[model samples]
Target: MALITKTDLYFTDYSWSAIEPDDPRVTGEPDSTLLNRKEGYEILYFINKLSDIWSLKNKSSATKIERMIRFEVPSNIHSQLTIRIWIHDNWNESRY
Candidate 1:
């Protein structure tokens, strides 16, 4: 059997005040808010490449897979936030 390694991305330090309305640092616009802070904030992370090397050795067998990702946010922030995830096979280097 081959070893499967896993990694995770953790997000923290999110506070209501940091993203509240009328936060000048968020944007120069008078009505700036966390909802429209900037374009760069839209992306969370990117994986350069993902390959199923094990598939080559087990071509005739089907691999059973379950939920491989878990997203957890503090209960306190759950009601006040919106989260989105996007998966793309290719990404721009500059975006990283």
Candidate 2:
């Protein structure tokens, strides 16, 4: 596999201009107002399995990162729920 950079994980704000330019909500919209206008996102549970994948014998070859996320949303909501995971990458840092 290839290296994972910061830009690969970056998510931009939602824009209504592309979908509906004539909509009143899209006119002179603030940065916050343009983001996630319809969907609701919540993180119910997040787990990082670092120790399970880390091995002393294969430390040099163990470069992959594994993540598991679980979300439980109620059926009453009309719109779909969204979830995002933010990761900070520090090349100089030794700690994983």
- Alpha carbon lDDT of each predicted model: 0.21, 0.22
RMSD of each: 16.5, 14.3
Q: Score every model by TM-score.
A: 0.16, 0.16
The sequence of per-residue lDDT tens digits that candidate 2 reaches over residues 16-95 is: 23435443233332222222322111110011112122222332222222111111222232221121112123212323
lDDT of 1 by residue, 3-79 (tens): 22122222232232333343343323212122321221211111111113223233111111111112232222211
How many pairs of residues collide in each model? Answer: 0, 0
Q: lDDT score, residue 50, model 1?
A: 15
Instruction: Please report the TM-score between candidate 1 and the true structure.
Output: 0.16
